[model samples]
Target: MSVQEHRRLRELASMHFQSRCLHEACERGLFSELERSPGSAEELARRLHLHPQACRMLLDALTALALLQEREGLYSNAPIASRYLIEGTATDQGEMIAMYRRSMERWEKLAEALHCGHTPAPPSEPDPRFIHAMHCTASVHAPLVVEAVPRNNARRLLDLGGGPGTYSIRFLLTWPEAEARMLDLEPVVSIAQEYAEIAGVNERFEAVAGDYLESELGDGYDLVLLSNILHCNAPEGCQRLLKRAFACLRPGGRVVIHEFLRDGSLWPAVFALHMLLSTPGGDTYSESTLKGWLHEAGFGEPVVSRLEGTPSSVLVAARS
Candidate 1:
């Protein structure tokens, strides 16, 4: 192989080594401990009940990855790691990392899924860790999505597939008079309720538990949000859901869809692979394709807006 091609192949081959190193570090609470206080590998190993050599190697790998900093023999979390990876922080992403770690097993079977032409079935009971991970993610994205949505006289909202109802809570916060109904899987609804209560909007928010495709989403909503929901469904399923959203809205009401558009971004493209491994037909869709689906679902002309501070964008369509 050419030198350049050989180097690229080597990089790809060793990608999993870094992934495992980070995953193992997060799994072992290394970041959290380091956030509390810097320590030598020996001390950390004693505290965490790990071998000193293994702990040192892991800490050195994290330092190389820029997630941690080592001074002499003491290690501490880097600023980025302290902000996001450390548990109990306001912006903690530890749950999301754990969720990714949990999914690694399913992702390992990608070749088998390709050969069998089907992804594995979802667990009957939803994993609470996954729900918490989604909650953490939604908390970060809710403000961007709320900002992208057009402010109007929207008093009622239906948050379809709302994981922890973060978007709904944000919207309610933006419009004090607004009330929201969040529809999602049964297990997720409880999480949503907890978040809504924490946000002090539980009285204004209602949690409805059931599959959006099979559930009865009540009618006459001024707005409907399909945030990050389409990527979990096939194109046809997304179209059907849009139609349902259309039927649920009041006349001239709007439906807002938040998703990672296939707009030549590396993140969305890589996220598409995550969908391939996790869902049967779920994948990121192009903006033009989603617009076409919205049109076919009887919505009027759609306006697309890129969200600030995220790789996602929103498409707004009105029921005419």
Candidate 2:
């Protein structure tokens, strides 16, 4: 390789350096400390009870990375750090970043994972930290679903494989008379019930727990929602699910799928890598594919609309 190419490889391999800087800073509450006020390296070392010289070096590295700024011999978190890294903020994504590290650490086995066609390392269950992080994330995305799915006194809504239940809650809240049933894994269903109760909509929210493949979805729904769930399964799985959704809907009933969709040609989509990391068989497909599925599932021509301010689109089909 040329000199520049060799240097680039070295920089990419040093990815762990950035991860450690973020993780240690978060674990030590360094961002929160700096948010209160800038402090000299010695003062920071005393506050955090760390070795003064080592602390100064780490702080300087953070400054070099632009996560922090140094002026007048005092250090402060950068604006982005102060806004998104500090704990207790509505947009605090530090826990998620930490969780990413936990997952990425296992991805060091990417070669083995690829050879075996499976993740060589398994993540644990009852991962409450990841669950809470997902809940926070879903809450952040719920408003978009509410705005995308048209609501006009709908009596019932079915949220298929809805995680966190935030989308269903948002729907119920937006349309007071609407009732929703959430279908998901048992662990996530348990959490969803708690969210439903806390939202004071438990009476209108029912939890159906099981795998979507084997369970039969009951009929007579005015609206069926498959929000951000279709991409988790393969194309055949999506087809089966769509047909089942059509069968469960009342005649002329609406079925809406909110998903991170690619364009008709399926290029320039950032979330294609997401499928590589998460779903084993499924990958992001073009809007035309989704429209074809909706039509093949015995629905009329579907209308695809792009959601504003999000990497998502809504495909609405009417049962014929």
Candidate 3:
């Protein structure tokens, strides 16, 4: 390799430095505190209860990364950070950043997974912030996705493994007469229920706290949504889940899958690595692979769509 190419390899390896720095900034609420008031590093350290020297270094690093701005030694949120890193704002994604931080430990196990097929150890306790972090990520795209899916004048819907139930809430809003049943882990289902109540659609939403794959999901649904869940299973498991989805729908009912298609993109390709680190045999699949699974599960020809502003795509098909 040329001298410059060798240097680039080291740079690529060290890219995790920037990710760790950003994760720490989010964990410390740096952007939100800075948004409240621009302050010198010393003032920020005191207000945020950080070690003085370390805080100064972190603030300067964030400034270098353009997530924060430093003017005359007073640090404040950069515009991008102001818009998406502040807590409680409409587009605040600080929680999502935290979610990435939480995954750092799992990511570290990639070498083990590669050599020994090791899965990262699960968290000792369920994370309460995870569902909220997912909400932050989903809220932006839910409206677009829900609007794109034809409501089909149907009344019953099932959201399998629907985290935070943002899609279900949006579905209910789009189809005013529709009722939704969202199944997920107990804690996650509770958050979904809370979100549905907040959306004023709880009257039409039911929360089922159980395993999406094994739960006795009642039949006769007009729609079944498998959003972001397929990638957690191996092909065989996904086939089973798809068959389950097929059986739950009424005749002529539709099933919609929302996921990142491994379509020669850098994002889903890297995300597949994360799945390897975390799941037993999970990985993102291509669109053709997904269509084959749908067909094998007894669905008709599928229609594929990539959400205009997001990394996710949808596959829609109906039980014949």
Candidate 4:
């Protein structure tokens, strides 16, 4: 291999190694320990009951990864790690990382999955761990979605496949007079209800439990939301769902889709890897596909807006 190619390979190996270390540290609560008390490697090893040499090497590696800092032999978690990576923090991304681990394992068989034109096994429900991951991730993204949607008190919003009612709750908070219905899987309804109650909008928000494709929706909603739902279905399923959403709206109603959309070109489909591992028939949709769907579904003036703080975008399609 050329020298540059060899250097890139080495860098990639190191990156994977560092990611593995982060996962291990997160699993073992090492970041939490450093948050409570900064210590030397020997001290941390004693506290964690790990081998001193191994702990030292790991801590040094983490320092190299910029996850920790060492000052005069004292090691401490970085601000980013302490604030967001620690277990008890609201922004703790451990659950998301753990979910990614499961998804990553499935994605390792990407070549086979693509060749078979099928996704790997679907996970059975009653999975508290996975559910928690979903809730945590939704909680992280809800605020952003609420901000992106056009603000209006008179708008009746429907959060289709709105897992955990995160976006719905945030919208209710943003506009107290706004009423929302969160439609999602039957099992996720309980989580959504809990979130609505916690957000103090249970009375205003209704939780609808059913499959989106089969559910009979009511009309007259000013805004219909489909956040992170399209990626769970195949192209046909998504097209059908969009058409269904379009039909369930009154004149001048708008459909809002919050998703990880790629640019017009299919180059660098980042979220494709996510769909490949997680959804049975799901795939990331492009802007053109979404715009075309909107047009075919009888929506006029489709506008795409990039979300402020995430890799997500909002597609607003208004009913004529």
Root mean square deviation (Cα) for candidate 4: 2.4
Q: C-alpha displacement of 200 in model 1, angstroms? A: 1.5
Q: How displaced is residue 24 in candidate 4, in Å? A: 1.0
lDDT by residue (1-320, candidate 2, tens digit) is 89999999999889789888888888899989989889999999999898999999989989998999999999999988988888887678786777766766555655665577655324424366666666676776788777876675578898887777878988888888999998987778888888888889999999888766668788999899988777867799999989999999999898999887877433325355444455565567778888888889999987777777667778888998
Alpha-carbon lDDT of model 4: 0.82
TM-score of 2: 0.80
> Candidate 3: lDDT over CA atoms?
0.89
Q: Candidate 4 regions off by >4 Å?
A: 1-5, 124-126, 152-154, 264-268
For residues 1-320, write the lDDT of model 4, one tens digit per residue: 99999999999767667777888788878999999999999999999999999999999999998899999999999887987788966678888777766666776777887688766577745355665677777787778777766774446888888877788888898898889998877788888898789789999999988778888888888889998888878889998988998888888888989887866534228567667766777878888888988888899977788876667888888889
lDDT of 1 by residue, 1-320 (tens): 89999999998989878988888988888899988889999999999999999999989999999999999998998999988988777688888888887888888887987798667776667677887888788888888888887788899999998887889999998889999999987888888899899899999999998888878888999999999889988888899999999999999999999999998898789888788888768899999999899989899998888877688998999999
Candidate 1 colliding pairs, count: 0
Backbone clash total for model 4 is: 0
**Clashing residue pairs for model 4:** none
TM-scores for all predictions: 0.94, 0.80, 0.93, 0.91
Residue-level lDDT for 236 in candidate 4: 91
Report the Cα lDDT for residue 130, model 4.
69
Give all candidate RMSDs, comma-separated: 1.8, 3.7, 2.1, 2.4
